[model samples]
Target: MKAVQVSGYGGLEKLELVETPVPKPEKGEVLVKVKACAINNTEIWMREGAYGTGSNSGWRPEGIKFPRIPGSDITGEIVQCGSEEDRLLIGKDVVLFPFTSSGERGNEHIAEDMSFIGSEYDGGYAEYVVWPADLCFDMPLKTYSDSAAFSVSGLTAWHMARQVDIQPGETVMVTGANGGVGSLNIQIASKVFGAKVIAITGDLKNEEQLKALGAAEVLSYKSTRLQEEILECNGGPVDTVLDVVGDALLAVSLKVLKKGGKFCTSGSAGGQITQLDLRILYLKHITMYGSVLGTRAEFKELLQEVSNGKIQPVIDKFFPLEKAREAQDYFKQHGKTGKVILLPKTGDDLQI
Candidate 1:
C-alpha cells in the first residue's frame, strides 16, 4: 500500500510518498480502503511540531512517534473485518470517530486519557488503514470526499456549539468565521438552533456569504476599534463567543462579551500563547470552556444532522494523495472558507 509519511517534524519537505505493506485487521479492528481524506489545521500544527510544550519543539500525544502517517478526517469503505460479528460492516462506507477512548465512551469530558487519530497513531493518508471497529460509523453521503470533508471539522464545530449550548434567540459570536470550523459554526448556530449569529473575520469578502449562512452580522477582526464595532453593530454584547483564533484576539473577544456570557474555544490558529485579564474573567462572571473533540453522543447528533441534510460540507480545494505537500501549502496560504480534500490516485497502493 502507498502512504504519505511524515518522517520528522519540519516543513512540507517532511512529507514523503512511499510504498508500504497492506495492514491486516486485528481483533476488534477493521481494515478500511481509504477513498478520501481531508486536510486540517491539526495536520499542519503536527507537521510543524506546534502541539507540544515549546513553540518549535514538542510532542503531540503519547504515540506521536516519527515516520507516522498523518490524516484523521477519513472516509472509506471497510474491506475486511477482524471480528466475526463485525463481518456485516464489510463494504460499509464509514467515517472515523477520531478520538481514542479511555474506557468510558459516554463521558468524554472526564476522559482525559483520550487521544486522536492522526496524532496518536498512523492515520488515513494511506491506501488502507486499520482501526477499532467501535470508532467507525456508517457514512450515508454520496461520495467519499464529501463524507471525509465534514468528519472532523463538522464534529469540532458542533461540539463547540454544544459546549456553549447556544439557545434559540440567543446571540453568539464566531471568530475566524470564514474558516472550516468557524464557517460551520455559523451554520449550526443560526440555521440549526435559531440563534442570532455574529461572525468575526479578517476577510470582508466573506460578509455576504456569511450572512447567507445565517449570520446576523459580520464584524471585521482587523477593525481598529473592533470591540466598539461589535458592540455597536450587535446593539449590545453577545451572549456567547465561539473563538478558534486565539492570541491577543482571545482577550479582545472576552471584552466584547455580555455579562455572564459563555465562551468556548477549540483551536488556536493564531498562535497559542496569549494573555488574559483576570478582572475581565471574574468581573463579568463569564464562563469559559476549552474543547477538543466531541463525545460519541454529540457525534451521533451531528451524524443525524448530516444525514438529514441539515448541515452541508463546504470544500475549498482537492488534491491527489501524491500532492499532499502542495495541498498543505495551499491550505496554509489560501484556504479560508472550507475543507481541503485529498483523493487516492488510481492504483497508488502496492499489491503486496
Candidate 2:
C-alpha cells in the first residue's frame, strides 16, 4: 500500500509518499478501500506539530505518534469486515465518523477519552484504512467526492449551528465565510436551520457566491469600522456569530453580537490566541461556545440533510493522492470557496 505520512511535522517536506503494509481489520472492524478524502485546516495544524503538546494542544485528547498518515475527512467502500454478519457491508459505500470514542452512541464528540482519525491514528492518506464498523455509515445518494467533502466540514458546521441554536428570522453571522467550514456553516444556518445569514471574510470576491448560498449580506474586514458596518447592515446587532477564523475576528464579533447572543466557534485558522475584554462577557450577558467535531447524532442529521438535497458540500479542487503535499500547501496558501478533495490512484475518474 502507498500512503502519505507526516514523517515528523515541520514543513511540506515532512509529508512523504511512501510504501506501507495494508492494514487488515480486527474483530468488529472494517477495512475501507479509500476512494476520496478531503484536506482540512486540521491537517495543516497536524503537519506543523501544532497539536499534542503539553500545555497548548487541547484538540488532540490523545498523544500523537510520528510518521502518521494524516487525513480525517474520508469516503470509501467497505472491502472487508471482521465478522461474517457484517460482511454484507462489503462493497457498500460509506463515510467514517473519524472518532475513537464510545459515548452513549450520540454524544461521542464530547466523550472524555475521545480521539480522532488522522491525528490519533493512521487515516485515509492511503489506498486503504481500517476503522470500527459501528462508526461507518452508508452513503445513500452522494458520490465519493460529495461524501468526502461533507465528512468533517459538514459535521462541524452542524454542531456549531446547533450550539448557537440558530433560529428562523434571526440573524446569524459566519466568519471566514469562504472557507470549507465557514461556507457550509452559512448554508446550514440559512438553508437548513432557517437563520438570516451574514457572512464575514477578509475578501468579498465570493460575495455573489455566498449570497446565492443563503447569506443575506457579506462584509469584509478591510472595511472601516467593521463592527459598525455589520450592525448597520443587519439593522442592529446579530443574534449569533459562528466564527471559524478565531482570534482575528473574535473581538469584532463580540462588538456585533446582540445582548445575550450566542457565539459558537469551531476553528482558529487565523490563530488560536486572542485578546478578550472580560467586561463584555458580564456586561452583555453573552454566551460563548468552543466546539470541535460533532456527535454521531449530529453527523447523521447532517447526512440526512445532504441525502434529502437540502444542503450541498462545496468542493474547491481535487488532487491525486500522490500530490497531497501540494494539496496542503494550496489549502493554506489560497482562500478557497469550499473543501479540497484528494482521490486515490485506484483508477476512478473524478466524479462531480
Candidate 3:
C-alpha cells in the first residue's frame, strides 16, 4: 500500500508519498481500510516540526516512531479483527477519536509508551490502518466520507461545550467559526445544544456559510470595535467563550465573558503559548478549562449525534492518496470553511 511518510519533520516537503506494507491487526485490534482522513491544525504544526521541540519532544508517550505517517482524523471501514472480542468493528464504518498517546498533540505531558495516530504512530494516510477494535465506531448515517470524519473534531467541540455545562439560551462565542471544529460548534450550540451562537471570524467569504450552519450572528476579527459588537449581540455578558485562536485574543475573550462565565479552549492555532496576566483569573473569578481532544466514550457519543442528524461535518474537498503531500500543502495554502479529506483507495480498485 502507498502512504505518506517523513523521515524527519520539517515542512510540507518532508512528507513523501511512498509504498508501505499493509499492516495486519494485532491482539485486540481491527484492521480498517481507511477511506478518508481529515487534516487538522495538529498535523500542520507537526509537519512543520513545531511540536518537535522542548517539552513536546519529551512527551512522545508513543515515542518517536520515525518515517512517520501523520494523519490522526480518519474514517473508514473494518475488514479484519483479531478475535470475537476484537471483532465488533469488522465491516463497520467509523471515525477515530483524536485522543492519542501524547494526549493528541504531545502537548504538556505524554507517557513514554503511548501516542495517537498521525502523531507518534503511522496513521490513515494510506490505503489501510489497523485500529484497536475498541477505538472504532459504527458510522450509522447517509452522509458521505467527509461528514463521518467529524468524529474527532466534533467530539472535541462537544467536550468543550460540556466543560461548563452550557445552558440553553445562554450566549456563546466561538472563534475560528469557519474551520471544521468551529463550524460544528456553531451547529451544535445553536441547533442541538440550544445556545445562542455568535461566530468570531474574519472569513467574510464564509459569513453566509456560517449563517446556514445556524450562527445567530457573525463578527469579523478584522473589523474595528468587535468587542463592542459582541457586547451588542448578548447585550452584556456572554455565558461562554470557546476559543480556537489563543494568545492575543485570549485577553479580549476574558473581557467578553460575563462576570462568572467560563472560557473553554480547544486549539491554539495562533500559538500554543498563552502570554496573559494571571491577575485576571483572580479579579473575575472566571473558570478557564482546556480540552485535550476527547475520551473514547465521548467519540462514540459524538458519532451517535451525527448518526441522528443532530450535527453535520462540513467537508471542503477530497484528494487521492498518491498526493497526500500535496493534500497537506493544499490544506495550508488553499482556504477552507471545513475539513479537507484524503481518500486512500480512490480510483485504484482497492477495497478492504
Q: Please tell me which predicted candidate would have the highest TM-score against the true structure.
A: 2
RMSD in Å for model 3? 3.4
Name the 10 consecutive residues with the lowest summed lDDT in model 2. Answer: 54-63
2 or 3, greater by TM-score: 2
Task: List per-prediction Cα lDDT, in the order shown.
Answer: 0.84, 0.86, 0.75
Task: Report the error of model 3 at residue 111, Å.
Answer: 8.2
Instruction: Report clash pairs, candidate 3.
Output: 61-111, 61-114, 62-114, 71-118, 101-114, 101-115, 101-116
* Cα error, candidate 2, residue 295 (Å): 1.1
What tens digits encode model 1's per-residue C-alpha lDDT throughout 1-352?
7899998878899999998888898899998888999998998888787877334332233535778888999999888888899999998999998877675656763465666677667888988889999989989488888888777788889888888888999999999888888888999999899999889888888789888878889988888989998888888898999988988478778988999999899888886998788899899999999886688888889888888887777788899999999999988873267788989863634452
Tell me the tens digit of each residue's lDDT in model 3 across 1-352: 8888866657777888887777878888788778778877777677665655633541253335568777777777788887778665666876665444434432312334456677766787878887777667666565437555586578778778777787889999999888878988898888877999889887678888898898989998877788898999779878899888887578778888887889999888766787777778778888999775656656666777777878877888788877777777777652478888887763346544
TM-score ranking, high to low: 2, 1, 3
**TM-score of model 1 relative to the true fold?**
0.94
Best by lDDT: 2
- TM, every model: 0.94, 0.95, 0.89
Off by over 4 Å in 3: 52-55, 58-63, 84-89, 99-114, 333-335, 346-352
